[model samples]
Target: MRAAERELMARLPEGALMQRAAAGLAAACAELMGRVYGRRVVLLVGSGDNGGDALYAGARLARRGAGVTAVLLSPERTHPGGLAALRRAGGRALATRQKEDAAAVERAIRSADLVVDGIVGIGGKGGLRPDAAPLAELAEASRAAVVAVDLPSGVEADTGEVRGAAIRADLTVTFGTHKPGLLIDPAREYAGSVRLVDIGLSLPDEAEAEALQHADVAALLPVPGAESDKYRRGVVGIAAGSSRYPGAAVLAVAGALRGGAGAVRYVGPAGDAVIARFPETLVSDQGPKRAGRVQAWVVGPGAGDDAQSVAEVLAQDVPVLVDADGLRLADRDLVRARKAPTLMTPHAGEAAALLGVSRGSVEAARLHSVRELAERYGATVLLKGSTTLVASPGGGPVRVNATGTSWLATAGSGDVLSGLAGSLLAAGLSALDAGSVAAYLHGLAGRFAADGAPMGAHDVSESIRSAWRDVMS
Candidate 1:
């Protein structure tokens, strides 16, 4: 972003970039307000260009007959040109150093219809400063709508880590291109909705992270040809469930049947339950070695103390997907030694276990945690949560699944995802493609099954075909 800004600045006159940003911001704020005239707008000014953008935008609002007040956090370090422009346009400025000024700032926040948060930019780290923390709290408690310039204050732009108090904007108007923090959460939760304003800066085709849309997922889904049969399409092996939890085996097989794979092979102690629920399953209790030929293997869903099966599947040359108990039972050396692709699907808790960190640590810094897990495991890792992320060991762009609802937190959801992803792998997609596409379909299916109501894991599994058809349509 810095490089793109520098290149654009070199070709244009001084202050041109800031002017463009302020104009876009002012327009967005106007649209939000419905009518800017006679509305109360408060600008939270900082010490950098972010403050400059807010002040200039405040000037635009003031010119349109709106009451504008600039609360400068750093009086001596505020933008000179921006402050001059705001003053010229009849916008009032107040400093937070004195108790009286602080009280006035609070009063302004309480009565304002709109508050523009420009206290910190993408470059600012840690959290809101002690002087500015109270203002952030005030804005949050206010009934007024908060609009963030560039990004919300105190968010780590690259990592999306909010270590302390951060502004929760109702809307964030970003400049140039989208930052990684805006797409990934914990910071994404703070940025309510994002609007990107183009500033004519050229960027690279490949980014550090990317979110897949409907068109992208449609192109990656596997479709069978006229001459294709069950073997040609792909057969996926499932080694899940135990006597204690036979339902896991049934759910895994259910998901694999709906996936692109032509056939599903189930090998576990729950063969009777698997055949009863999914009569089409090729059942065998002799284990994965004699479960018939399969293009890929999915291991460890509900296999209580089933480390032997996980090890057996890892020995195979075909692509392997490890999930649930498999994530816990599989050996680190065995996973890293795989010649073919290995995909590990883990929630925050499982990822923390693998990384030897707390679940809170992994949840706080999801981007860092996922990437580190991929690099450490030497395989493709799919870290599932509010925003499911797929990362490969090659250090390319991580794929983020934007679809899904809070209802997906139900039981056996991860099993369905493992079967779907393993089936995709057997169908000739790469580890990255399989993990990302499965996550997309699973999330979409979860949304369809729930539809604002509660749904079981089997409901999500049954909705896969509908999700696939929706994508294909």
Candidate 2:
């Protein structure tokens, strides 16, 4: 589902999709309430199909002997059929006829047992209006477990932006496919844990995906065969690091060693330093072309704007990771015509340069920007930040690194990510697989290394083995 958004809505009727959504939502409520016998189910209803879905689901719960109530925000514009259905099923429907203030709504919301927020969905624009703002505040402050209908209300379904205020849900029962807002952050902050309900609405072919699951990540990893030796697995060449920045190369190689590889080959002025730190790495003083056969190349971590060296590495016939300076030196045609896979690991800034857009633009719409980069360069792209997203040009599951700790953002952290991913590429995993798995494993390692304390890049690299051990068990 990676096609354009407008095209996705073309296949289904809006009304039919709503009914299917309500049905799925009712089923989830039944499961959550266990037997649904005399349990209080409160729906903070709004003036949209999202609220309609909630009211209809409340009707179903009332039918099953549960006590359900819908607190409508817009009484005049409530879903007509939904009101009738709730009454028939022995559910009570109430409107905020008192004060139309945020404080009054917050009080009602705080008193709920299982609160259903039908405030906003994919069609919403901006933040919560004052009338509905207090309800969101109450949901956050209360002991009630909020189960949002469609998506957490007040979240931008297209972009992941949370404007003024948003409902923070313990569980969001989203209709149809996952919206981009639920997957991307800022808004992702409000959505506690996302759960999907398959209604019949056809998600657009261009629907962006996020966070690859562990089983998928495991499949992406390169496991060695019995006959494979160090030479046969694959050799990865690194042209990162300079006299000015020697530590970046060290961290990259440290990560590379953990990436399932036959061998790692290091070439550049940092040879002495890299060898001194990682004695296992095969260091060479020769040029990239003369550095011998390699299955993959990891370039640009600390390599400055040496145009000739960057071009030489790009000219090679292996999978390449263009990062830092490598992104600046890249020729569009050269990238497209490359003999093997290409993976670009750029933070928001680098992606902005490649797309000729502002850094804020990339950060604001990371999912879209990463996919655009992949399609533009015909490569896999990993956009690193709070939610590390890996998007492939081939339209696969986009992986988000949820395992990362805040401490993982230290200097040279990204350098470590590159080396680890490059090693996986050398070991024969596809670009998407290698990049996503690296992000996952790297985050896990970071958490292990840091525990609760702040850490340097070396500590994160050192934690790789322990994290791997835990995974094996």
Candidate 3:
């Protein structure tokens, strides 16, 4: 982003980019207000260009007959030109350097209809400072809508880490492009809805992070050709479930059935249960080695105490997806030694176990944790949570899935994801593609199944077809 900004600034006249950014921000704010003529707008001014943007935007609102107030955090360092512009347009400014001024800022914030958080930009780190923390709290307490400039104050732009008090904006109007924090959670939760304003800056072809959309997933999904047959499509092997949890086997198979696989081969102790629920499954109790030929293998879901079977599947030449109990039992060295593609699906707790970190650490730094796991395991890692992330070894942008609901937190959902991704892998997609696409479909299915109500894992599995069709349509 800095590179793009520098290039654009070199070609344009001084202050031109700032003017464009302010104009775009003002327009978005106007739309949010419905009518800005008589609304009260407050600008939380800082010591940088972010404050300049807010100040100028406040000037625009003031000119349109809105009551505008600028609460300056650093009176000495505030943008001179922007402050001058706001003053010329009849916008009042108050400093936080004095105790009386601070009190007045709080009163102004509580009564305002709109509060623009320009206190900190993307460059600011470690949350709000002591002097500015109270204002952020006041903004949240206010009934007014909060709009952030560039990004919400105190959010780590590149990592999505919120260390301390951060501004919670009802809407964030960012300049140039979307920052990584706006897409991932922890910080994403604070940035309510995002509006990107183009400032004619050319971004790189590949971003550090990416979110998949319907069109992108639709294009990636496999479609059968005229000559395609069950064998031509691909067969996926399932080494999952035990007597204690045969439901995992059923749910996994359910997801595999809708994952574009030609057929599913089931192996392990739950053969009778598998055949009972899904008669079409080619069942065998002989284990992964004896389960007929398969293009890919999905091991682990509910394979309790089946370390030998997990090891056997890892030795196969085809792509393998490891999940649930398999993640715990599989050998790290054996996983790293595999020449074939390996995709590990682990929730925060499992991920923490794999990395020797606390679950809290994994949840707090999801982006970092997923990438580290991928590199250490020398395979693709799908870290599942609020914002599911798929990271591949050798480093590139991690694919983020933003379609899921809290309802997906139900049991057996991860098993379904495992089978679905494994099926995609068998059908000729790369490990990364299979994992990301499966997460996308799984999240959508969860939403469809739940729809603001309680939904079971079976419902999510059954809704996969509908989710797929929704994407295709």
Candidate 3 achieves a global lDDT of 0.93
TM-score of 1: 0.97
Question: What would the TM-scores of all predictions be?
Answer: 0.97, 0.82, 0.98
Clashes of each: 0, 7, 0
* Colliding pairs, model 1: none
The number of clashing residue pairs in model 3 is 0
Sorting all predicted structures by lDDT, with the top scorer first, yields 3, 1, 2
> Candidates sorted by TM-score, descending order?
3, 1, 2
lDDT string for model 3 (95-201, tens) is 98887887788889999999999998889889999988988999999999999999999999998888999999999999988888998878989999899999899
lDDT of 2 by residue, 267-360 (tens): 8889989988889999987878888889999998888876667788888888898888788888878888787899999998999999999998
Model 2 regions more than 4 Å off: 1-42, 56-69, 84-106, 110-114, 125-134, 141-145, 158-165, 175-177, 197-207, 394-399, 466-473
Error of 3 at 260 (Å): 0.5
Candidate 3 vs. true structure, TM-score: 0.98
Candidate 3: segments with Cα more than 4 A from true spot: none
Shift in Å, residue 314, candidate 1: 0.5
